[model samples]
Target chain A: MHIIEVTQLQKHFGDFKAVKGIDFFVEQDEVFGFLGPNGAGKTTTINMLTGLARPTAGTIQIAGHDGIREIKKVQRIIGIVPDESNLYDDMSGYENLVFCASLYGIKKQEREKRARQLLKQFTLDDTGSRPFKAYSKGMKRKLTIAAGIIHNPTILFLDEPTTGIDVESARQIRTMIRSLNNQGTTIFLTTHYIEDAERLCDRIGFIVEGRIIKVEETQSLLQEAQREHIVEFKVEHLDEGVIQEFLQSFNQIQVPRISDQTIRISSGRPIELMPYMEFLTSHNSKVLEAKLVHPSLEEVFVHITGVEIDRLKKEKEGKK
Target chain B: MNYRLMAYGNILKKDMQNYYLKPPNLSWGIIFPISWTLMFFLRSGSDVDIKAILPGVMALSILFGTTSMLSVTITFERKSRSFERLLLSPISLNLLMLAKTTGAIIFGIINAFIPVLFASFFVDLGGIQWTLLFSGVVLIAVTSTFLGLFIAVSVNEVFEAQTFSNFFRFPMVFLCGLFIPLEQLPRVLRPLSYLFPLTYGADILKFSVNHQASINRIVSFAILLLYAVGLFLVSTHNIKKRWIY
Candidate 1:
């Protein structure tokens, strides 16, 4: 049975469609990722599933429980690390975790034990007497995650778990999530970190403009990524512009500094590679070292979305 | 039903824990009202009828201390999106509001009665009707909490809520018959005092303290209850409509 399911889910804030008819499912232990650029409705979708946001239309079911009609049952088994930690700055990391555990009706002694265990697992300082305000951003993020799992929920909803965290903290969180999935916990995560998603998620759904434009296994998505064939030539101290002209025959190019008159041109399909190579030979362009590199997840995202993820993000900010 | 009760319990715990964890806020919440009681004691000495001022003081506690705290704190949570986190916790909004409002009730009573300890030394504390005082405390707490709920729902920011509560709190402190009787005000203004829930709250509380359970006091009690319950529902409803998808 599907451990999680969302069908035709939609939500709108006034005139703006925050989520537009998205559908997907997660197995009992799969780490499913909802990947998108900022403002692409990843959070909106997770919010709806977490029962923080009500869907304007369609249905969301968690373990056969309707998110709208049977939310309490759903909440009972889901631990959510919201996009923002929202932990009380006045409370210690230990207090924050134990406090959340208490809300689930865990006894204080049990909560204390669990909190200690979690802090140790997350490599947090055992002396958590200091206020959360004193913690570094990574420390706070780890504390929030610990707070989320204190109840030992069956499914976890993580919203951009590493957005503001450092690379080291992000890696630790990813490792923890993998261990949780191995223990039979289903995780539905949303993140802007394409590489993190590529590395950790079993399947990724690219959300574009409040819609799921694409969803596939990470390896498949990478395989489907638009190819950029690179052609290069080495010369006996020729002008850099001359090689640039040969490289210009292709659409996109990764330009590197030249001391030995060598240029690498990044372009479209393998067919485009032949023309650029032939043009180089015809023009007496001495090609040094050139080869194609597999596209990165970021590049794959840019290819599928028809806009560079970075540029699209900038445009989204401009619109906002 | 258990879920609701538990949710209420959790909400109350959250607020109490928050206040206890913050020393500055805890001290500020208690100081103003306690100071007011000390001032009264210094003037009246042992001869003063402390019970006479209990009703008015209770109203004052709700207004400046409880209502202000509720509005400001809830608005702070709303701004931080913490309220949304709670709402998303799969708990009923009604239960959550009930818990929070109950916290307000508890806070209002403590803030109001914390002065009683200092005043008891100067006045005949044993002779006062504990039942009457308790009634006054309940009314004060319920009224302030509902008013705070309304403010929290209407205001977008904590500062805005503070400003808005001031518009009610400052007037209620004086003209709402908390410290001054409605009879002391002009007849024209006497009718206007009814517009403030604390005025009716103070009136009923004071009358209850005197052991004179008049029909007018009952009317005032009904009016106070209606405002509290009515505003509580309205605010909770609007919050759901405002934030829920």
Candidate 2:
């Protein structure tokens, strides 16, 4: 059964529409990623699903409860970790988690036990006694996620789970997310990192300009990206003469660029790597390495969404 | 325990820690009332009877203490975005707001007694109506906390909350018969005085402490209750309109 079903969901602020009637669904125990650029209504849609924002139009059926009319019932079964940490800063991390669990009607002893287990799970056990404000960004993010799941919610909504944190922490959080989903929790993840969706998500939805452009299985999208063939050759002491002659020899091949002893060749059809290696060898240019490159989810995302990879990379770096 | 009560207790506990348990806030709650008492004596120069001004001072103490704590805490939480966590919990908006305001209501009630604590040392409190006194203090706390909630929802910044609280608080001090009697005020301003919730609260305190009141006891209690409910409804509406979406 689908864990979440949203239809024609729209949110408007004044005259501007933040989410322009988007529809999507998350299946049980699957990681459904809503990937988009900044201000692409990813967070807005998540807010509507989680019962934080009221929709201007359409319906949300979450776990069989009307999200708009019966948000309180839906709230009990779901958890939310906002883009920013919403846990109390003045309280200890442990205190914050226990308090959040208590809001779900967990008894005192059970909440304490769960808080301890989660603190250890998130590698925050040692610093659990410290105030939330004193923790580092990564620790704070981890604690916030821990708090979100303190009651072992059926579905967890994470907004930018890995943004603005250290690399090691981000990796650990991704691992934790995977572990949670493996344990039968449905996850709705919205992220700026296409790589995150590539690695963690089961199905991907591409949203642009407040509208969903595409929603497809990860493997299917990657397979479609494979239609374009690319080959890269790492050569030693590569010069302009080699590239000019190499292009002249292979007219169907397009040499995208030559930089740092590497030449990237692209074509609609597969190119024979041996011919290129022998051609370079005959020209007295030593070919160090040559390999066919598989297209990444990022390539598919760029192809479908039409947003330049450079712009997305800058947004990711700026977030970091 | 029931889940609703559990949510209420947890929210109330957290807010009490953030709003009242801190040393600075605790000290401010206690010291502000005492300071106001001292200032009253210092300004009136020794001949002014403590009993004559006790109702006014007690009403002022509850007004300042509750509004200051509740408004600042609400605005600060909203600014830091921590309030969203409470808003998203599996509790009704009314329950959540009640839990949030209970801490400041308790703080205001405690503040109302600080002046009485000082007054007990100098005067005979044998004839004071203890039932009326307790009822008056509670109603004042409830009304003042709701007023704080109103101010908190109406503004975005901590400073703005403080400033907005004063916009109602300062005017009520003069017009509510806290320091001056309602009869002594200009005829044109007396109608305005009745509009403030504090005016009825001050009257309740006066009847309780001095055994003298201009308005009927039932009318004062009813009006104060109405104001409390009215302010609470308006603030929650504002929160739903502005913060939820």
Candidate 3:
């Protein structure tokens, strides 16, 4: 079932169009990833869907409620975990969770019970009594997510859930997202990390500069990515001259300069490794290691959105 | 309706814990009243009767306590993005904002009494009208709290909130007939004094404590109530216009 159906949604900030009349739908119990570069209107689109930003023009129907008109009804069934941790700094983890549950009209006893359960589920039981301001980045993120789900919302909107957390915490959060999806919570996720989309999202949408370029099943996108053959060669004594010579010799393939001592060649057709290996060896470029590169969602994102990989990497660095 | 009430109560309780019960705010609540009372005596000299300045002291206490509490709490939460959590809740914006301001209102009311408590030790309290005093205190607290909410919503940073609050607070302290009577002011400034809601609030406290007021008692209460409602409506409008986007 289509739990969320947005049509020609638009959000304008003065002359800049943040979300320019885009359309999309999310199915019940499916994890949908909205992937884009920074300033690509990913957060703007989520804000519109969640009723934080009123659209300049469009229609949004969530769980049969008009997103703009009956927003309170829509809000009742949805959970939002903003990019920042928005829980109270003075309150404890348990207090924050219980307080969030109360906002959803949960009974006091039930809210306390649920808060305890969520603290345990998020592995925050040990630190439940500690103030949120004292929590580490990962624990703060965990508590914020727990607060969002305190009411057991039918759909959860997570914006950059794992952006700045530790590796272990990010992995645990991913596991929890999977578990929540398994238990029939529809997830609408927006993320900077393409790998997160590949691992957790069933279907992915690529939004760039306020326009959604493509939305497709993850498996299908990966299949399209598989059509291209790629190989990375780690070498010594490599330079711009050697790269030029290699590209000139192998005119059928495109060699992207990986580094001074490494190069990656990709093409639509299968690459003949022996000739390229022999040519590099004759040029005094020692090929230390060569490996076949399997395309992932990162490659698919680049291919579909046409955004530079360096730009995305720069966004990660800037966020960190 | 029941669910909304529950939501309101929860928001109120949480804000009370977060912004009101903290040691700084608790100390502030106690200290502001004492300081204002002491300042009144120092400015007017020790021989000035405490009863004559009780209304001004109470009004100033409520104003400073409420505005100071809200200036920090609201702006800090907004900066931290915690206010967005309340904005996204299932309750109506009106209810959520009212719940957020209720703590400050209560704090202001309590702050008003600390001065009165100090006065009762020194003055004979038999003839004072308790009902009128309570009504005046509640109105002053509500109006002052809504004024703080107005200032808080207008600014983004806590320091900006403090600065902006002073832009209103210090002006009202002088112009609202808190320390100076309206008739004693220049004729031009008397009209200007009437522009401030605190003017009506101070007048009400005066009528309650001294049985003397420049404006009629009914008009003072009505005007004070109107200002409270007006400030609240404008603040909520600001939130919808600026904060939501």
Candidate 4:
């Protein structure tokens, strides 16, 4: 079942269109990743879907209810972990969770019980009593996620849940996200981290400049670049001129230099090692190592969008 | 059990724990009013009517304690983005505002009571009308709190909210018959005093203290109620319009 369906979603801030007619849907019990660089309207889209912001134009349906008109009903069925860990700073970790539960009209006893369980599950049992302001970035992120799920919403919207935190905390969050998905809660996550989307997302949507460039199942997206093969050869001495001259003899290979002593050659057909090995030997450079590399999701993103991930991030931050 | 009431109770409880119970807030709400009252009493001299001035002191306490605290709390929550959590919940915005206003009113009434208790030591309370005083306190508390919420929702930052609240509050202190009586003020300024809710509050408090039915208590109460309801609606509308991204 499609738990979230958005069509022609648009948001404008004065003359600048933040999100321009974006359309997508999140399936039941699936970890759907909304991937974008910083200023790509990822957060804006999330805000609209969660009813924190009104769209300039569009229809958003979440958990079988209209996101705008039936906002209260939609709010009841979806939990949102915003990009910022914005729980009350003066309240304890446990208090924040219990307080969030209370907003959903959970009984006091049930809320307390659930708060305790969530603290334990999020590895925050020991620190639950401490004020949220005193928590480390990682602990704050964990508590924010825990608080979002305190009501057991049918769908969870995680907006960069693991950004700017320690590696261990990010790992723990990823694990928790998987566990939640396994338990039948639909996850709609927006992230700038390429590896996070590559690993956790069942389907990935590439949103650039407020438009979803593409939305494809993770495997199928990677499969598009699968036909190409990368061959890495480490030699005793590397010369770009010599390697280019040798590669000129073979029209099928495209050599991209990795380092002085290393070069990667990509080809549409499988690269034969013997011809490249012989060519290198004739130049008095011994092949130290050789390996085949598969294209990563990051590479797929670059291939599809023609924008490097790092450059995309820098541009987004600059716009911000 | 009503879920709206439950949500309101929880929101109030959380706000109390997070903002109201802090030492700075407590000191500002409780100690500041007492000190201000003491300063006013010392400066006004012993010959000045203490009974007449006590009601103004109580009104001032309600104004400062409720307005400043509510403004600070609302702006702090908005700046920290914690207010977004409340906005995203299934709870009604009206209930949330009511809960917040109720919390501020409770604090305002408590703060207003301290000076009244202190004044009781110097002046006899036997002749004072208890029912009128109680009604005045409740009405003024609601009016001041809603006014604070109005200022809070009008601005986006904590500093701006505080600045805007002071801009509204300081004028009321001087012109709203708190420090100067309407009859004593210039003819032009007397009309301006009526524009302030604090003027009606002071008038109500004055009638309660003097045990003289000069001003109609019903009119004063009705005007104060209208101010409360009007401010409440305006604040709610502003929050719905400006608070969302």
Alpha-carbon runs more than 4 Å astray in model 1: A226-293, A312-320, B1-11, B20-22, B37-52, B125-127, B210-215
Task: Write the candidate numbers in order of decreasing DockQ.
Answer: 3, 2, 4, 1
lDDT of 1 by residue, B1-245 (tens): 35455556766887888863368767866787676766777888956567777666656866677777788778888777667657766567777787777777777777777667655766666556677667867886887888888988888988889888888778767778766777778877876787888777776666656554323766877888899888888998878777764
Clashing pairs in 1: A233-A287, A233-A288, A234-A286, A234-A287, A234-A288
True contacts kept of 1: 0.32
lDDT ranking of the models: 2, 3, 4, 1
- What is the C-alpha DockQ of each candidate? 0.39, 0.65, 0.76, 0.60
Candidate 2 lDDT tens digits, B179-245: 8889999999999999999999999999998888989999999999999999999999999998987
- The candidate scoring highest on lDDT is 2
Residues A91-168 of candidate 2: C-alpha lDDT, one tens digit per residue: 999999999998999999999999999999999999999999999999999999999999899999999999999999
Deviation in Å, model 3, residue B3 alpha carbon = 1.5
DockQ of 4: 0.60
Against the true structure, candidate 4 reaches a TM-score of: 0.88
Give the Å error, residue A120, model 3.
Answer: 1.1
Judged by DockQ cut-offs, is candidate 3 incorrect, acceptable, medium or high? medium
Tell me which residue pairs clash in candidate 2. Answer: none
The C-alpha stretches of model 3 lying farther than 4 A from their native spots are: A232-265, A272-291
Relative to the real complex, the DockQ score for model 2 comes to 0.65
Error of 4 at B104 (Å): 0.6
Q: Which tens-of-lDDT digit does each residue in B57-112 have in candidate 3? A: 88988999999888788889888898899899888999998899899999999989
Q: What would the per-residue lDDT of candidate 4 be over residues A1-320, giving only the tens digit for each residue?
A: 88889999999999999999999989999999998766788888988998888999999988778888999899988899988888999889998998899988899899999999999999999999999999999999999999999999999999988878889999999999999999999999987677798889999998989999999999887777687787878889867777666768765566543456776777778888998888888888899998997877866776655565447566545533
Q: What's each prediction's clash count?
A: 5, 0, 0, 0
